[model samples]
Target: MSGPIPVADYMRLALAQTPQVSDQNKTEINTNEQGYYMKQDVFGQGGDFITSPEITQMFGELLGAWGIQCWKQLRGPSKFNVVELGPGRGTLSRDMLKVFSKFQNVVGNDISLNLVEISPFLSQKQHEVICIPSEKLEQDQKNLSPPSNSYQQGFSKDNGCPVSWYKDIRDVPKEFSLYVAHEFFDALPVHKLQKVDEGWREVLVDIKPDNEKEFRFVISRHETPMLNVLRTRYPKLFETSRNHLEISLDALLILEELTTRLEECGGIAVIIDYGHDGTKEDTFRAFRKHQLHDPLTDPGSADITADVDFSIIKEIFSDKALVCGPVSQQTFLRRLGIDLRLDNLLKAAKTEVEQDQLRSGYKMIVNDMGTRFHCISLFPKVLEKYLGRLKFAGFHE
Candidate 1:
């Protein structure tokens, strides 16, 4: 008779027919869907998309240099934490650790590496990569062994540093920490809202009755508590008639905890992602096989993301931390000496093919297309003395 319903259609039906489904529920449905990340290789080759770290070694190397500078500005803390949120495959940390290993005398050897990652598959991949020595990292890059099915879960060691995985940032111990979150916030769930005649209503997902299997966006009938809070706190967002808005409460909550930690313990955090500084626009999107796809087409087969609003982050941490430029990624990396690093690598290149690859990767991350990605740094206000009047490379003119 009739063929079985598609997974996407079945999911939409289940969610829509439920007693109550909020915007948050839709986000959870998409993000935590079974076989989403595991079935579809979402990072690097054979995956839906790739990130900057995947594009070039220079990307991670420059970030490593920035970390070293920050460490020095903090007066060379004897024991500090290097934390990375959503460290995909640990490529960035591995590169940074290589740099730290080189300057062990100056940066000290008492550093602990903390990676906050949720995907079991990604965690295993990170563990394998993080344990590889930098000298051999390039050689072993192509032959990455699939993660063992029976791999142990939890803390492990990489070089001299103790590597630990946590489900949430709250699990990380309270310590003077250097934090980096590259392309992390965009994946977090966002609640979409639209201005209404009365006030504002949340956008929800529902199954089309005639189609029965297809899904469509429907605005809520009444205002939600989140809508009321948004109207009161960010009246400017609602100034335009029928303007659509998106907010990531999860991102703000994490920022609140991070700021509190930075205030209590001296440290700096670097956030780099693609988004506008303060401008508002609907940016909900999906990626499958490196191409844009309809977000509602597949429940768990595609990657869902949205542009981050850096202005909100700056506002949240302004009181407790010195917020630096949300400058273009091009400017930030160049100021941090990416060009010099690339030149040095070029000189070391043994083959013309290798040299060409390096140049291509460099352009992919530092060219006009990549400049849309922004970098922001936050330093605790209490550490101003130790940080002195030091002009951070990326943020300073």
Candidate 2:
């Protein structure tokens, strides 16, 4: 309902208004103007939105199963760590370890549980979930119900790896392998661009004057080198018919760094998030409370995300890593044995209500996340022979 503002003035206004980038405030309106992640407001039943980990124990369990498969491929390293990025409520980590423990010792002094969380709020919550004292862990082990014959028969001989918590990926042992990032990539900041009469212009956020209380997006044409970089680095993307392209430099940088880190370390990193396949649209959008809202609605408050341009990613990393998925989460889970896991789970349920909830969770992953939510996986240094030098189908150069 307001007049459109040019992106240049918008960026200038936002930057001039930027409170701070680091240090104490913890509020992102201060830091994120410079491209940093704002702290998440994660909590009990009333947060921004619930993640897959919060949805069902099954998601974490399946990921745990997948991790175990990767670990087996790693020859069962006895001393590696289990790491999760942006651990919210620590549910996924807990669920992951639960499955990991079924195959290997979990609540032991040696295994380290490493959580890489930036928000103090989420980190404290994660600490409560994962860092149970050694004494209590021992007691819980004794109190734990005896494993079913299937678990005992399938994973009885496996040894549990130690756990370690890190605030940054650099802190994770370069040698320690298997990694999981569930819904992590989407939260990263992506640059929005719109081609113009003159040239390509970058989209930026600026505070509106009507009351300076809220922020809105504005596009400013670039007369400098960023335009060059955008044109050169993303030619195919720019050439596409989209009105704008939301570029995830963070995703690219993260993949690049992960490839370098795991090149010598040897591990598999699995990424599951709500996204799309090709590098084709401006999918920048936001969710407030639970429903979708205009992306310009709220800057720091709403959960903002964009559909992933995974084809661009393939172009970037086809040489170093074996990237799979970008497949449906439903499809990936099915291939990874989620159907078998759920059938056993539903049959084991003693009550109707419990069976219904389990069935609902299973449907959430397969039906909703299956088609709409994409899964992109990375097998660094592990799947070279299987994927190496292949033509890399699904995209044309």
Candidate 3:
């Protein structure tokens, strides 16, 4: 509040602070935003951004089908988890749960849903869409007790499968879980590093001298702690020709945790995001009302993100698991039969509006998002041979 800070700290402030950055003059400020997410609704046409699931039911349906197929590959475990990280508005989970509901007879009542969400506002929204209040859940909460690991628990409205909420993935029960992280890694805090004459220096945010309300990027005059760690951990990144790039230590740590889970628990993960293969640099930006916005102009007024480096994830996954293709969303979806699903929906359309939506949604996801967004998967290394022979759907080995 009094001095220059890291970009990651600014982001945490922007995302969680209720008062304007101008309120820096105040002695104290509220840490938790008051109904910010409730008012912002930062997804879909009316919000700052829109995800694929918001564009069409097909997106979720296909992912749901993918989950089932993966579970089948897990030998139809007697009990397992379907966990989603950063499920916004629960659209994907809702659609996936619907598909899972149809397979109850085969999967039995052993499937559980666990959502790793940090935002209370979004978590409530997710709960509203994915769960239905029931006497059994209430009884379980009262007569028994909710699991200590979760803040809330319930039953899926679609199939009465047990559903739980966790603030962190580590808190989720250790089970053979299928993890889905759609556009999650990009949102994690990233440290902007620049190659300086001596070494790498961190990019920081400082209040403009003339305008206290405004922020500007400033390079550190001295090496920061993050710079030292990056040098030690990824010395090769410094060897690149590029002078500037962004790296998310948080993202790398999370990927390592996920890989450890898959290696130890026998599970899989599907990660979808718009990212580079360790080639591009300076991709951090913001969006407001579906348009690009200056991230430093008005903090907390927009959604900030950076392109994920899939190469980093691949490296981590490859260490302990069977890393699959970092394929384009187009390739992934087409492999999963999006075209056939679209054709079927088009044939059933009752009006021009429905047909147009179907056609446009298909094109947007396949052509627009399909190219920009990439999908990667991780399976336990034990299945490397089995999966190599058959290949994971939507991802060529």
Candidate 4:
């Protein structure tokens, strides 16, 4: 308590006394850290890192078009919802709304925008972005200010699209909705497990006994129920030496809930994140000021994330949802007409600087590093006929 206290210190103390801290408890550290966005700018050039939507307007535009096509396939409901999880700075939502506004005839005007965001700081930024006109967005960006009531109960833009914010996806009303989760799942907490002699033990954070202020990764004394599930579900993991596995049970639970909602109602979800379909490597990482750091070093000060295991996602929704491509982001965007959109933007560029900015954004999303990121789309089985044999642009070879 005297010197610098690690974010895990309090939890470690609780675990020492009770010795029964659940895996969920370990995940809370990360979630709580993320919820502290009010104290940090974790997005854009001024922050630690940037996302796809931040890289290019074309990214959001393509997704908006894709969503519109899916809406048509779903028979174009009179009233539907457009939801985005963790809509950082509201850039993607703004871009998507622009497309929706342009194609109002087909997309319809009776749509509500729902965002599941917990951070008050980000929610205000989102409100500002979505509520402003496209033409004024650039000019307003400089003079933008956080609303007095950061926790907006309800808001809307001039277009009459009611915008509401929720802390959890479950709170979003059940309806035909289009969902977008961009780099959302990676932020969810993951439980780290390592192969052990007895079985598999969870990796936890604890204060180093010799250096009370320092934290270290310590294995649990006994195997958890989660380990048993992993052993049964993935026996091959044990075959290797020092096998370390990280699984986001929180992410799986969210997907299950989303799948159920999609099946009950009628809609689709597109998930874009930096991860492989599936892998068996420890991907727990932290970023601060755009540089990687030890995740345990600074808890709330750094961004902690792991590569999503999209293979598990496909398996989970295989029956309930029509799971499509865990395809590469590059292929997905290109298939969604990113090239054509880029060319059009370039032709319209008024200056050399404008042209260069557009090119850099295009390259960032389609290059080798960007190609590693993946996009997966999910919809209920009932829409199969409407979708027909037509493969989604990114999902097909």
Candidate 5:
């Protein structure tokens, strides 16, 4: 345990300990037993950071509109899944489902909600907000069958839409699905690699000799598997002038799974996160109480994340799916009619506090998240021509 390990390995070890609410032994997530994400409430004002969905209903509502449009483009399938990766607090799901409810008759009755989440505490939180009370789901939670892929199941409080929970995306039934991965890929573990005179070397985490609690970064002396994979899978990364970069293999694998599913079953995917077009370097960092924190300090105490390299995403989907705008969040939202939504909300505001809240949320999403975050969409390649013929809501200038 004292030996140096790959950064990705360290991340997995740290995140693996995120809280399981059902675990009787661990009551406090801030303790050594907890991990970065599930250790405590890590979203909104009191948590480590805030996400778009938590910021305002509009973020999810816009996404809901996008989803419905996508569903229509797919010819309004009789049965489809709305699979959300990392359904934090289940806020976006709730918002999207509320939108989905209005068109139940058009989209047909076989809509299912599948959430890919691991933290027991967060999953429970998602359930409370997303699902109506169900004794069956409660019993399933208490005595989960070992063989079932879904650990819990229920129906949406607003629409009576069935919802299911799975720890991994593969467990979600392969069907026509509208996928959402807001801020999901960035949280996956990334291996920091440095380009040396001879070849690529990996930056690893090691225990400081003087203090067991402290950790430091060390470069591997020899070539590693990650280096080889990086070279083979994405040679363009090496072409970059930057000497140091972080790559998330988990993210690529998830994209592969998503692309395959879309190819086979027919679907669309939206990925919204803070990232770059493979131009930047050294973005692996942590946050605690809405401030930047040392990732190695208190290992699992803070949320660890890295900026996504969106260029690689484009590369992955190049041949398989039609990759649409990895556009700025501001542009996407504006194109999606966020301004109109804001105006309508402003009109409906009953008090100054309500109006201020709406305005603030709009500023955060449009002015802050707008510029920082990026949005990308994926559709089956068969729709390439069809998509071109139509003006996609968010991609245009």
Candidate 6:
């Protein structure tokens, strides 16, 4: 707590200070491993950046249709759940189920709707999404001000799902039919390391008082025992990767669980994040209030994240599932039916300028947002055999 603590000790203190971080509990993750600082850092003006769903209802609307369709394909699994991982503001989930308010099933209890998240603030915001507590997310949502009763009210089953916030992934409700993870993986902790002509090196954040007060990145040797465990498990990362490359062991492990869920359990997993595919260079970033900043400069104020590597996910799953293109948010939504939805909204009411603004925002989501953000879907390998004569039947099968 005083001066010049070794990286290991600093890390130990960090783990102690970190609340609601399951990954931090791992002994191996706390030491030399880099990244992974999951906590109550999302939302409001001071917190990290906002997501797509927070930007527009269109994003959530399409995802909703996708979830419902998945439910239909799963024989409308009577007891299944429409689950969302890290449902920020719960906007996506709320907007999605808006169209499913009246869905009826003759099951004993009906479907379970669930959201998995850690932040209590965001948790409450989700109630607004479900029209439960009926509150706006940002106090500002109240200012833009829609009519008091304009919020859509849908009929949902009383046997609703609980908002599970357990730290461990094992604690998530098992056997969920459709799971949505939007802009989630990019925020998960990633391991940062650089390779030299000789071998690899681990990166560490060191505190320094020599310059009055500050912390900085200090490169260390790769042969450390901590690194050996990671490299042993993921040699292909080193193979496809080049010198000075950054690897997201976090992403890889998430993929392992994702594939396992799709294979063992029946459902599709959608991942929307910012990144590119390649055995290329590193991609780590820090953001504060919608602006990118130097992670090294600030200890915890800046939101640190990295490029999501969706390219290697197929390789990780092999022939286990159907992996779709990491298409633009614009193209994917257009295919899933955003234009038609907007058209109906325009036809129904509102002024021409309001409708035009919606159209422009839609374009920004693509040429501006979707171009940077990407979406991918993984359908279980066995699903092809099960899907009837649907459009994706032959292709997925």
| Candidate maximizing lDDT | 5
- Return the TM-score for candidate 5, rounded to 2 decimals: 0.91
Off by over 4 Å in 5: 18-32, 135-148, 233-236
The better-scoring model by lDDT among 2 and 3 is 3
Sort by lDDT, top down from the best: 5, 3, 4, 1, 2, 6
lDDT of each: 0.73, 0.61, 0.81, 0.73, 0.83, 0.59
The total number of steric clashes, by the backbone 3 Å criterion, in model 1 comes to 0
Q: What is the TM-score of each candidate against the true structure?
A: 0.83, 0.76, 0.92, 0.83, 0.91, 0.76
Clashing pairs in 4: none
- Candidate 6 per-residue lDDT over residues 1-397, each given as its tens digit: 3332223333323322321122222212223322223345466455667777776677777786676676566564566566677777767776666555534332234454556665455555565556434242335433443322222222232233323333334445567467788877766666566676668777665554354345555677446554686679865556654565555665676677777777877676788888666534667767877888775553444566677776767555656777766776667777777778778877875788878877776776756887787777887776666545554321231
lDDT of 4 at 87: 94
Q: CA lDDT of 202 in candidate 1?
A: 81
Tens digit per residue, CA lDDT, model 5, 1-397: 3346788877766676632221232212233576766656788999889999999999999999888887886774778679999988999999999888877776667788999999988998999999887664555454633335998777788877778899999988888999999999988999999988877899987666666546788899998888888789877667767799888889988898999998898988999998988878899888889999988777677888899888878875678888987899999999999999999999999999999999999999999889889999888888877865755679865
RMSD of 1: 7.2
Error of 3 at 73 (Å): 2.5
Positional deviation of residue 347's Cα in model 6 after best superposition, in angstroms:
1.7
The TM-score leader among the candidates is 3
TM-score of 2: 0.76
Q: Residue 123 of model 4: what lDDT?
A: 83
**Once model 2 is optimally superposed onto the true structure by TM-score, how far is the C-alpha of residue 263 displaced, in angstroms?**
1.2
The clash numbers for all candidates, in the given order, read 0, 15, 0, 0, 0, 1
lDDT of 1 by residue, 249-350 (tens): 778778888888888887879999988776756888878888998876655667777888887777656777888889999988888888898899999999
Candidate 5 lDDT (Cα, whole model)?
0.83
Write down the lDDT that model 6 would get. 0.59
Shift in Å, residue 290, candidate 6: 1.3
**Model 3 regions more than 4 Å off:** 18-39, 134-144, 234-239, 385-387
